[model samples]
Target: MQAKAFDTHLFKRILKYTKPYKKRYYGVVMFAILLSVFAALRPYLLKQTVDDYIAPKDEHGLLLYISMMGIVLLLETLSQFYFVYWANWLGQDIIKDIRTKLFQHILSFRMKYFDHAPVGQLVTRSVSDIEQIARIFSQGLFMIISDILKMLVVLIFMFYMNWRLTWIVILAMPVLVYITRIFQRKMQVAFEEVRNQVANMNTFVQERVTGMKIVQLFNREAIEYEKFKDINQKHNKAWIKTILYNSIFFPIADIISSLTLGAVILYGGFHILDGDKFTTFGDLFSYTMFIGMLFNPLRQIADKFNEMQMGMIAANRVFDILDSDKDVQKDGTVIASHLKGNIRFENVVFSYNDKENVLKGINLKVNEGETIAIVGATGAGKSTIINLLNRFYEINSGAIYIDEQNINEFQMESLRQQIAIVLQDVFLFADTIHNNITLNNPNISREAVIEAAKKIGVHKFIKTLPGGYDYDVKERGVMLSSGQRQLIAFLRAYVNNPSILILDEATSSIDSYSEELIQKATEKITKNRTSIIIAHRLATIVNANKIIVMDKGQIVEEGTHQELLKREQGYYKNLYDSQFALES
Candidate 1:
């Protein structure tokens, strides 16, 4: 991709976040003005002390000048403190607001977006990139403004003191400005490289760490380490390139600043020795200080300009996500309450990617409070049916209805709230078991969670743990066994009292004893409720009210266990017999 230019439109959008804190922003600007005023007064007072008081041998006048100079310095120091404090405070508040907004936007995106986007890249944007934006407010824009004001005030005094010496000093400025412009362009490119490399490194590390198990299991530690080293080297080189640019540019600026000071002294010294009444030793002294002051802000402006460039680049990345239109379909206005659980899929066709259909023209129906079990091979589109019913992805064509009303007509949140799912890979947050089960929902009280856990038959297993329901699961439930995590998922779904429940390969990867317990729990939970079970093991769904056998995105058989078994050469019979023969 071509590098994004610094976008004024995006900058204006970022500035809107600071609107609520306009008073604080104004406070920073006011303090910056006061700081500049005080800074200018210091050298002017120093000149008066030397020329008017010390040269005249007036002790009282000298003392007054010294004291006033001290007072100006003190006020300058105070203004500096407030300027820094308030500017940083404003930056932090703006970034906090942006981070919250970015996160909320991310949450609204469809699963399809996440399927292709890297988790670490998103994390880096929300955390590190947002921080760069904060620096624009705190260390970049406001500070640059303060520096410019100070330089302008100093220049005014320089011209007033001795316009001839001021002209000599100003002659060297164009060279420095030319050099700074070139440096700014190069630094902008360097900073962009650094940010890109950082994102790449973050993505690699996050994926490897999350999949560390596979790395060690396959004994690929050395190979992975080498890959990480390569990424790290690229990151290091990108940073060094930035450092190299800074190292060359700042010294050139310093050299130009010194040359300007030299020119001021050369001209002022000639006029002083010529016994010109217009030029005095104090004028030369004040002019020297003012020359340094003029060039100092210019140098800082170059540095702060690079910082602003970085912030703009970061803002471009953040805005890309914010502006994305690939969010979940959430346009339905109907609020579905107490759905009777009647479901019908009519001529449904779907595809995760647009290239090929996963479920091709499927049609099925289940009455209220019936348990329907789906059995199919690995890629037979069994789970895709459940994904469609939950509206995780939009169907390419056809319609899904609940209670004789099209599912699309129901509001997304209301429809999802009425359905609960227990997936084969159970995920638990790093929190107490109780919080994990209730998911921090205040309405699901502790007593209700405990009662639900008991109904699902996972209550005794939870109580045996040291903290019972309060036990922390840690990370992705690493503290618990696979079966325990499954049980927790069951309790979580059970407490919601969903009108429709889905158990997708819920008993596939567990010990036989846990399987028996889960089966019993399943019997209780599936009773008098609409349930769909996706199972690979044919025996698990033998008692299902109606069994639907799928093959390659098409339903091949539909019947009870006995009815399907009686069919000669049927897909369900063949699948059941193969497993049964293996056991025999």
Candidate 2:
């Protein structure tokens, strides 16, 4: 019922990802072919020894034949060993390559893509999906080739011994193929359901763990447990159906194989007694052994058919992500030679989706070495403006220029490197304070990190902890207070020393005393750079060089603090009055 994910176009495209491993893949194929040939040789040699040497008591012939068979088997074992070892290595490397590319591709997508997609589903597509593909490549693909080769070799030898006897044995071939096709179709449906249920279970676990504190506070443990149990039960039921189909397939194939063996024995025995045959006792004995060898591989191929189909579906999903176009792509072969920190937005129109506009024909400009404040009601597109400037999303129409050159003309990485943003919501990795501050910048020294921390007023507080800069902030920096986290976020932004800075309510979470400290540090940080602050508290930005008032995605007013305050009939006056009333 879910739209078919098994797109042939996507499958062929994904095969291109294997181009780098051609040598290893060829090695696996050669080894499988050799192993199959050697495996088929063993029964034929045994039959010759049993029918001729053992019956006539020819000691020399028996020893020579047994020794040759032993050597063949030893070589086969060695071949299998390398096949498994190198095949595993190759499969892992391919998955690693695919996952690395997939991860980078997802990161390159526009912010709206992440906003609309689930984090857990992305994680599953990256990890679980790739793993499924690897299993098919390593086990399913290699085994299939080997089994088919071995089956063909056995069938050839069986017919060579006696064509009439071989036909008697293979009369069941049509039925075997028919039954395997049915099982393939049935198990494909059931196994696909199993895979979907597993992904759902994964999503459930991720969500519950992320919100565990909220669940505990509300005392909804039992309810959450019941929900998880229901999901788990669905997964269990899907798996049961898969097992049931698989279990029925092998037995049915086995019954048919047994019937073939019985027919061979009865028919071949009659020919031997009548002396009206194209086969001898030894030939019939060897032929039946060859027929027996075909069963295991045939049955295995039937089983792995299900794995192949599931893997194809997963590969299609993964490649779909990898093949997605970058909507916020860079352009031109030019790089910005100089950035003077000046920024201008020219009649920009933008939206996450085109159906509705988040920012409608907004125009504004900021000079180098100036501080501009943006104040507005919630959902008034303040942060959306920041998102546009940073090129997290492309404008629907109109151009934004930096120092007179359109920002889109410069390479994306180079443009972003010159800018830094400190948001109201701070996120810290579960790592040490030093790593969090430097953020793995190889060129950033410890002294530089500490200086940035001191400038932002987090140095003294960090040193008071027992581990100092080595202190670990677990899980989004939950170990620190809101103000402390804000200070760290500021230091992170300041450590980069960008030419342009965007501070979106950087001091909104701190108390008055800490806010005063932050205000001093902020003023020092923004002195000679372009600063755009989305101020939550109007007082913080009252001293800004310019203040822009926005309403419903339009900039209705723009001027210095004194100029805007003196204006008649503006949104700035009402905002200032309401905040003053609330504080008083």
Candidate 3:
């Protein structure tokens, strides 16, 4: 574990979230103070009752003193309840705001950020890490303050009662503080390791569970189990280390507490044996109870300190994400509505991680209402072009224009509103088919979704299902077949009625019947819309007005299908001949 400096900035930022609930926070503080004052008064009242009433045989005075003691206890109990209630309430409200802000920040990041980030790590940050922050308020920070205040009041009353006995107890203070500092430093490293191990385990579990089908299909279940066992073991070790530190520190604190009590009894007993007029049995008894009160909070302070450290660690992890600059730059002020869908790429260069260019000086143009097909071998920059067009990744150089205006000049939301894409690997949420289609957009009504399904020729198939549009797709649409999922995706895209539609190998993996239905849908949807089709199946795009053949990230030929076939040694011709021979 690495050493981290105390982050004053992070602490102040967390304090800012409490501004909204300051009234509740101040209520908790007040209750804590009252509870401490009442707690300190308990032992003083006992001493007074013993010396002034019980020793003199004053029954009426004893009864009155007992009644006052009972009232103090009741006030102490009521304040304790308010302290606990308001502290927890304040913690919950603060974490709710923090979680919402963290989620919104995550939603603002670009595709590149998510592409490299593990899903489970992000989940742990959003869920478990934020919970640790809540503990800081409820269990760590407020409790520590309350204990410190109680200790201070106890010390003040003890010294006033008997300064000599107070000095004996105070002699052990330096030793206890030194031991606690060492424990805190060691536990800080242990807690960090525990948090990291938790994140690793979450990542491993999430990935394995999501890919369980692959693990079973390839007979790698035993191998994956072994891997999981290793990660789980590491997680266990991290936790055990923290527990070991706690085990060592707590008993030492208890031993010191007992020794302090023993020292007080021996010193005060000698004074009584010597016939000191000021030392009374009630005073000695009260010192014993006060000693217990003093050491008990010291022990609790160690535990609460650990909690505070854990909260600080969690806050650092969360702040790292909140402070990141990986979000897509959405600075354009122009709001494009009802775009004409004319697109052009000029000398565009791009790379996923900037290591090597995936798209190199690519240039192309598609007029409004034109259907263009991009054909290429794998990794030949076909899909990269589509990604750049959607602004999923910013181009390294060059400019892209839509309707003779720079695409970067348009507001991202307004620009994306006019464009729709049906990806190669269709993703369907664990939701109803209707909600998945409309994506819960209030502007898209149920009737419009049904009409769009009808226009795409999938309405009959959807109606044939058990619940029609209301059917739950289950996780990743596992309840539906691959072809069925693709049909649902097509219906989802069609309902949006986007001016520019992109189909990236959308019909590659389905059965012939589904492919034929999708082809019909594609023809109907692309009739008056600018569509970009990237497909390996040459037959599917034979009617495209223009076909661009690419190899090694550069365009080798551009023409109609029949015209490309006439070339003696063209990339598209060879690709077409090879696939045609295999089909025959």
Question: Could you give candidate 3's per-residue lDDT for residues 1-584 as a string of tens digits?
Answer: 23263557777888899999989988988998899899999999999999999999999999999999999999999999999989988999999999999998887787888898899999999999999999889998899989999999999999888888889999988888889888888888889999999999999999989999999999999999999899999999999998898899889998998898899888888888999866777888898889888888887888888887898899889888898875645547788888888999999988887578888898899999999999999999999888878777788899999999898888888888888998889899999999999999999999999888888789999999889999999999998999999999888888888989999999999999999999999999999899999999999999999999888788889999999999987889999999999999
lDDT per residue for candidate 2 within 1-584, as digits (tens), equals 23243456655665666689898888988998888888888888887887789878999999999999999999889888878876777778878998998988887887888877677778888999898887766776787888898888888777666789778767778888898888887877887787788778888899889889899999999999999999999999999998898789888988988888888888878877898647567766686677778887787787776666777767766876776786435544556545788889999999888688989998899999899999999988999999988788889899999898888777777777788898898889999888988889898999999988877677898999769999999988989888888888888888988888899988888877678777888888988888999987998998889999998899989998888878766789878888899999
Window of ten residues with lowest summed lDDT in model 1? 1-10
Residue-level lDDT of model 1, residues 184-268, one tens digit each, is 8888888998999999999999999989989999999999999999999999999999899889988999999888788777777
In candidate 1, which residue pairs get closer than 3 Å at backbone N, Cα or C atoms, i.e. clash? none
List TM-scores for all candidates, in order.
0.97, 0.94, 0.97
lDDT of 1 at 213: 88
**Residue range with the least summed lDDT across 10 consecutive positions in model 2:** 1-10
Ranking by lDDT: 3, 1, 2
Local distance difference test, each candidate: 0.89, 0.83, 0.89
The parts of candidate 2 lying over 4 Å away from their true place are 1-11, 217-223, 273-288, 326-328
Candidate with better lDDT, 1 vs 2: 1
List where candidate 3 sits over 4 angstroms from the true fold.
1-5
Error of 1 at 247 (Å): 0.8
Question: How well does candidate 2 match the true structure in TM-score terms?
Answer: 0.94
**Candidate 2: Cα lDDT at 59:** 100
